[model samples]
Target: MRDLLGRPADTATLSVTDVDAVLGEVAATTGSGSASRRSELLSDLLSRATAGEQDFLLRLLTGELRQGALEGVMIEAIASATDVPADLVRRAVMFSGDLATTAAAAAAGGQEALLAFGLELGRPVRPMLASPADSLDQAVDGIAEPIVEYKMDGARIQVHRDGDEVHVYTRTLREITRHAAELADLVRGLPCTSVVLDGETLALTDDGRPRPFQETMARFGSTREEQVRALLLRPYFFDCLHLDGTDLLDVPLRSRREALHRVAGEHVIPGEMAPADAAALLESSLDAGHEGVMVKDPDTPYAAGRRGRAWLKVKPSHTLDLVVLAAEWGHGRRTGYLSNLHLGARDPDGGEPIMVGKTFKGLTDELLAWQTRRFPELERGSDDWTVHLRPELVVEIELDGAQTSTRYPGGVALRFARVVRYRPDKDPAEADTIEDVRAMLRG
Candidate 1:
């Protein structure tokens, strides 16, 4: 081991069972009252692991798998290995609500056991996500019909109700029920005994207008109930995943929406179906002080945990393709994420990418996971503040404009920059140059 990896191995042997034992220890110790005892147990496990094994275990422990295979690849592998249909495997995994357990069952009990997995109450399924559309017309162009709704800028929430017990979950499936008892009461009063609702929740003014995103997030994310009492959250239901003892996962959006209207009544999101003109609707939505509009295909099923083209979100903003130079460590809910990104523009003279600004906005947990897994692969080095990476990945950022600044050598800084998406297909060379940004300053 020393000869191959240039690192001395303290342990002579390791096994899969040993790793599992260590995991059990860590899980048990994490909840213990003694901090010193937890640290001692963790340190002991680290000492027992070999260098290579340590790296693998750390990745697994932190949920930062850089092996290039996420759930999609795992499902494909399970299908190939077990001689089961890939679609069936996917459905089973989705229904079972977990990959690890579903794969084990498929491997152990074969198809018979795999077929048993189905939707159950109180167990949260992942929510469907949207892809960004450049314009409202572009969003409605391809679809046979589109449901256009005002896209509120707020927290994505999934509310699950079974009798008197109500659970509210964030987009990441973190249960925040205690912090939102009032919301639970609102849901309890809804016209259903059992239901699952997908929607957005945010602080609204007394006139029923939506507040700023930050103010909403502040109330939604606060641990102190009294501190956030002044800023109350209102929910707007957009989709129904289940209702009245029936599963709606395999049904079309139109059917689910019908159920949503029946169950949520006045709480159903405001929208128009197959409008004669989408541009007018977009203008109205913007004029009504919404972020923009969401254009959804009525024929598509609810694809949990998948970001597909069935739902399109159109936000009005100018975007630029820039390169990621470095990232800083995150905190709180963003603890393990590469939260803050150092953005740079392409040098017109073919030199190194030039730094222009920094941003930590518009990031979802899924995107943060992608960054945590991929950034280390492109790592050049690291200092105390940031993890420097190779300028190989391009990211699209939306900003108000650029301004002259002494902060960066590029002579300008992005005003209120936020990420739109990562551009995997584009190379760093093709990124917008400093000159293009300066042009924005002049414009």
Candidate 2:
């Protein structure tokens, strides 16, 4: 193996398992450890690995595998590998909450194993998502009747409770229980035992109106008790995924919503059967300080992790809310400030945001100062010219239009993109999708 790299063979061949073991050891080491120690550890592992193993290990460690395979690709691969129906496999993943585990079970135990997958208490099932609707009428165009609920701009939360023990997860499946003890306490007081709830959590002002999205995020991201105590969150559960040993994932939205009402009581999100006027309901939601209304079909089963037309989100503007991926250093009077912002659209397949365009317009001196101060805090890595961020901040962008572009990962670029405002209330998950941006190209 070493001969291929023009190096003399020095050690025995290493199996894939051996490489994994080394990676585990490296991952366990603290960042505070000496650089020499890390180098020595890697050297030892490399000495025992074959050339092919060494090459693969380096790429894995450097995150340059570039396999170009995402969950969607894996689902297709699993379907092909296990001879299982693709939709069945997708549905299993939706329930099981892990594609890798579902694929393994399907390969080992076949269709029965896939069918056996169900909602488990304390495991967060992916929240069902909504597709964007251009207008209220477009949203309710086909369905006989739909339920329109206020789409509050806030964090997506999935609360799982079994008896006295409770766990809270974000839409991305990150456990935030330690940070949301107040929310857990509220869940504990619920009527049912062993339940899974899907909801939105946000802070409210003293007058009982929703607070600014930034204030909600400050409390959501806080780890200190004082910070959390200062801003108590209220969870408005919209759907019940599981309750009292019964899984409601495959059940119609109407039944699940009934379960939500029974479990969450008054805390359930406010909604009514297609009100006499969908437009009025949308305006009411907006006037009540919400982003929009989610018009959902009651008979449709929850399609977790998938955005479908069964549920439609109606908002006022056609603007895309994107994440700030990176920013270049400013020039002239704006010197030392991070000026040109690199914007990206959310990938629908649950991957990193795809870079769409760069914009330097629509900035006031105040915004520039804020970006200069905040960009450093969100920095992932940086070169002399630009600073890359963690893709945590979502910004609303007003674009002249989008055009086909081979330069961007989404195969499209924004024309004359300008920042509308920073969306402190929305997560990257709620950002406008690549499909949403591309759809604008044709219009």
Candidate 3:
């Protein structure tokens, strides 16, 4: 792990293409073992290995490691080792299982195969980063830099496709493939012989308005995939990392967008033309009741697993009343209050509340005590201070839209999530919907 994640813990100092080189090297060295043999042997060894799993894994291969090894960094390394671009590596890790497979393909088959693998997942792995977009004036000042369109409230979806197979992973990279078949079918129809796309799926309400992002999430939680088809969820394509037989990352965002448009066609996210006047697009997206536009520099292509100014999502921020369904034990001063709360939205069709995100801030002492005494009631079971609840109550929580998660049940998770109030009068059915959450994306 040290070899993979050690250097320049400061992401600012790292090159966008570094990780891809590392992955290419490792995959090339894995030899010509069969996938089944590799899986069996690795799984067994992993089951018995004693050196902190990640540590041993990295030692077996030549790469860096660190305690909070950011996914983006590892992704870069994998792409580097495989001679593939960061985007393809990012997509593979995000939507598929076993990084070794991606590495092997990139090593032996090269970037085109990696692109094909990433596109196999229903939605391409989304490349995300903490937004660095400046205000409208700041954005306008950099007009010569070139920018692309981006929507606000949609869920960040990673689609992977392989031959006839498709999978939709949430932000956490969990396989919610079986749960989202309608979307799978839609993505399967893309014109590309093989492709992987990075984008968002927004929900439109019955009134023709975008709904909260939570509504879209609920649909993701449903075992019933068709629920979203009826709800009118529209996928807004933003970036393409893998094309028919090439990696777009080596190209520019302009090229990637062109490829994205060709494959997605009518399904391509609807947006205005450019040299897109940033001010005009800003006004257009916001005034349309959409969140805001993402301004992607046309000259830059996808920087897989890295967050740079290459793409910027813009929108006025908004919050919502989400529920607190689970509580994780706190650390330090919050050691006893159960600081980090696992939040959920009401399930309209009678399923467990789907997890949205976690927050340790925003709880009053009274509310914390209430939670301490009351939260256990919803527990399916408990382990020490932590309690896993049935996720029934509706708490008025708020936050920016969704992102991926590593520790949540539903694949996608939220950002800057906090509590505003509890909804005593509202039942789970009356609470926020996935569409509402998607609308927040545009905020």
Best by lDDT: 2
Worst lDDT run of 10 residues, candidate 3, spans 7-16
Model 2 scores worst on lDDT over the 10 consecutive residues at 1-10
Best by TM-score: 1
Candidate 2, lDDT over the whole model: 0.83
Question: If candidate 3 were superposed on the true structure by all CA atoms, what would the RMSD be?
Answer: 12.1
| Candidate 3 Cα deviation (angstroms), residue 311 | 1.8
Residues 1-443, candidate 2: write the lDDT tens digits.
22223342367677777766766676777766655565666787776766656676666666755444778889989999999998888888887788888988999998999989877787777678888788888888888879889898778999999999999999888899988888999999888778999989988777677775656767767887776776899898898888999988778898998888888999988778767887887888777777789999999888775557878888766578999999998865577889999999999999999999999889888999999999999999999999999999999998646667788878888876888899999999999998888886521
Each prediction's total of clashing residue pairs, residues at least 3 apart in sequence or on different chains, is 0, 0, 79
lDDT of 1 by residue, 1-443 (tens): 12123343677576777767766775777454756665566566666777867666566666764564778889899989988887778878766667888888888887888888877777777678888877777888888889998887778888999999999988877788877777899999998999999999878777777766656667656887676777878888999988989989789999999999999998887788898877787888777667778999999998765547799988778689999999988854577778799999999999999999999899888999999998999999997767999999999999856667779999888878999999989999999999988886521
For model 3, residues 1-443, the per-residue Cα lDDT tens digits are: 33233222222322325434534444555556655554554444334434444344555454332244566666678777776788667666644555667767777887777666533335444355435454755544554655546465667776766666777766666666666676788888776666677677767876656676667777767755467566656677666777666766568777777787888887776564454466777777667656677665677645444455655656565566666667887643445665578777655566767776778767887777787777777888778766887756777765656654446665556777777777888767777765455444432
- Residue 156 CA error for candidate 2 (Å)? 0.6
Candidate 1 off by > 4 Å: 1-7, 10-18, 21-50, 58-68, 223-226, 320-396, 399-443
Show pairs that collide, candidate 1.
none
Which candidate, 2 or 3, would have the higher TM-score against the true structure?
Answer: 2
How much is the lDDT of residue 124 in candidate 3? 41
* Ranked by lDDT, top first: 2, 1, 3
Please tell me which model should have the higher lDDT, number 1 or number 3.
Answer: 1
Q: What are the Cα lDDT values of the candidates?
A: 0.82, 0.83, 0.63
